[model samples]
Target: MAILKHFAVKNADYGAVIDYLKYQHDEFHLVPILDENGNSMLRDEFYFDGLNCNPEAFDLECELLNQQYHKNQRYDEIKCHHYIISHDPMDVADHGLTGEQAQAIGMEYAKANFPGHQALVCTHTDGSNNSGNIHTHIIINSLRKEDIASQLYTERAIDCKAGYKHHLTKEYLRHLQGSLMDICQREGLYQVDLLSPAAEKITQQEYHAQRRGQLNLDMANMEIMAEGIAPMKTKFETNKEKIRNAINDIAERAKSFEEFQRLLKAEYGIQVKDHRGRFSYLPSDRQKFISARKLGSHYDREYLLQLFEENALAAEQNQAQWVQDDPITILFIKSDLRLVVDLQNCIKAQQSRAYAQKVKISNLQQMAKTVAYIQEHGYDTQEKLQDTTDTIQSKMAKARSDAKLTEAKLKRVNEQIHYLGQYLSTKSVYADFLKSTNKKDSRQNHADEIAKYEEALQFLKQHSPDGKLPTMNDLRSEKELLVQQKSAQYETYQYFRDYHRELQTVCENVNHILDISQPKQQEQKRLHQSEHSL
Candidate 1:
């Protein structure tokens, strides 16, 4: 996938942009390396308007633009624009193109799009995530240099003003994405739908928060390791994950709609507001509210309401079961239990097939080894060969049994871990709900909060009928145990699997020797019979 990102530089010093792009800086070290004298030591390529500018003369050209466009309105507004043409790492690798080639593509695109503009195009080989994604930076002055009116006449007359600011519109950006896609396809590079909406889009603020939170968690873990103590959970959870989990818990309950709204406010400190038929959530801690639609399809009004209806129908059909099992356990019984069973069966099938294939391959190789062994060792007696074959067959049978048992244990432990994780996640939301409080408000405010609170309550009842859930510590302990057990089982399974292959090889080798000897013996017997008859 390729992305087109644009940013405006408001700083008066255009030379700063040139220095950052051309020079080796610690902040952006992925670009190119420089020696003690500050000259580039790596293959960092830069181009500007076809031979008029080099890295050394880049600042001079930018300064000339500033000098020519002195009549521009304000120094605070954007003076120049920086556009990035970034390609996917996989695409770059698949295309077998250098960073320079990628930069040239961006440069050509920029020139064609922004004619009569002084621009510096620099291609980079690495991305912020340390992935070797090929990207190009095209920094162009905001000032339009050419007399557009004199050059050409169109439906909309071009501004011939000396210092007209170049406007970037949505249509232009869309065009850039389409153009890049075409270029990628033509080059036979791996491409994705750059213009389509993403499945989940994380906002810049949330992204930064997650990164910061992860860094803090890492530092905390290091400290804990040094102290030989258990680490504590960080309070900084990304809103997206928190909200998604909360919504999932609520959706699963699917009680009355009114109860759903009430519980949302009372439990989670999240006020679900309806605005012109659209549902939005406003967290107590944040002033801004986000649309439910933005969260995902599950959180959409219709989908959530449908879940409530389904829950009601299920309760009516099986009142005894519904009354006996809590919402959480019911959820497990209905979905997770069945899912785990199916997954275990699938894993078993896959393992069986894989084991058979491995054994077959090992047997074939062993047969070849057996021929060589017989030729070298001169094993002429059938009795000695039969003894060796029996021993190998016995070992192969045991190995197969051991491998199967170990794999089954591993699968069970994994399923337990998965179940425990979901249970803990759902429990955490309920814990938050228990801790929340409802305060007095105006009639209208009360009405709004009441609606959300009722809905939330219904959600809780449907998800957790018994109202009693496992503690976080209990869940965590079980999870740790299961994870450890899984690790141990996996090691054992691998060992047995390797041993099984060895046994298969030995068995095949013995069988091959027997096959060769039996054929020779039959031929000898026929020759003996013919001699007796004569």
Candidate 2:
């Protein structure tokens, strides 16, 4: 799925943009990584070209153009528009996309969109996420150099004239996405819907927050695991996710809309308010409420009301077969992918960085290992491969479900042990308070212990239901077994998940090879043509 992203550079040093595009930089520290010789580290693999200017003299040429046009003179003015078109990783893995081809595509796009602008187009093989996605960078000087005929998505007549500044409108961005969709169709590459709102949209801010939070949590977890303790949380949930979980919890349990509101406030401190026929949620931390429209259609007022009605109906019609015990699962974890038939012809010639190019070839060779894996697993046909994938996926699902169940049991055991220990330690104080002739004085002296004893007692009784206190040793034994079981189940789940991913990739590639049905891609192409035609 290729998507268009844009940024405006306020600084006049157009050289920095080209430099960053060609070198390695530390994203975490926001600095350039110098080599042992104290020079900027060159990027591993890239394809670069300039439009209406020399690649080596891009910075000088852009400055001269701006001087000639007397544009982008102010310190705060946007000097250049940086546009990124990131192609799907699957395009490289299956559809044979390469940096050189992507660069050519980006050059064509830049010419078509910003016809009279001096631009630099560069393509790189390695994304920051190491996703192996082919992406192109198109940086156009805000000052145009030559006049051109008016094209599609141009909002104003001045937009096509020389000496005029480049203007990016929302309509132009939509048209860019449409062009990408067309490219994907013509090349038979995978594409995603770029026209409409995603069913679940995470704002750019939330996405970055999640990434940083997950990074911090991972470091914390490493320290925790080094101490030989299993970290309580392996994933970090954002504020929006917390709200979603809170809503889901209350949604499942509450019998009515009124009950739902009460439960949300009581349990999660999330206030759901309705105004002008729309629902908004104000979490405890936020000053302003977030609308359901931002959250998703699932959390909309109409959808939630329908969910509430369905839940009520389900409770009234609860049948014996409505719920069933999960079948037991045995868990385990794979390796392999296929090499492209001809890699040399697609990618740029490996001349400058032999070691880096070798690394890429190594990855290709690693992908070749999949052929041996397929034969070893006796996956002679695509059907066999798909069937095995489905079976492993089922096992993975069962493993995850069982692991969660074990975790719940472990939590209960831990809670029981804590309360029981507290109750035992405070039992003598409470007993003495009861026996004292001046009960008021004794209660005052032992207030803390008495309070602790009663709180523990209440919790134990509620959890027990039958009002029976299980032995400490029994609880301890259960906790020990649960810890081991949880560890095993987690390992099993991870194993099956990796296995499923590897096998699924192979299945998808096979499907691609045989030109199997892809209705979604066809539909996307059809829509692009119908809607984007001038």
Cα lDDT of all candidates, in order?
0.61, 0.80
* Residue 469 lDDT (model 1): 37
After superposition, the stretches of candidate 2 with alpha carbons farther than 4 Å from their true spots are 68-70, 244-263, 274-279, 292-534
Per-model TM against the reference: 0.49, 0.55
* RMSD after Cα superposition, model 1: 20.6
Q: How far is 516's C-alpha from truth in model 2 (Å)?
A: 74
Candidate 1, superposed: residue stretches over 4 Å from native: 24-56, 71-75, 147-162, 203-209, 234-267, 276-279, 290-534
- lDDT (Cα, tens digit) per residue for candidate 2, span 1-534: 887777788999888988888998876544788999999989899988999999879999989888887888899999999888988888887988888788888988888777888899999899865667889999989988998888888889898888898888889888888888888788787888888755455765677788889999999999999999999899998998788888888888777777788768755667888788887998866899999878776776887888899988887666323333211112212443643333344344454466557656764565456556666666788787777788879989999999999999999889999999999999999988888999999888888999999999998998874467766866776677688889999998998888777777776555543442377778888999999895
Clashes of 1: 23
Error of 1 at 342 (Å): 48
lDDT, residue 308, model 2: 90
**Residue 447 miss distance in model 2 (angstroms):** 15
Evaluated against the true structure, the overall lDDT of model 2 is 0.80
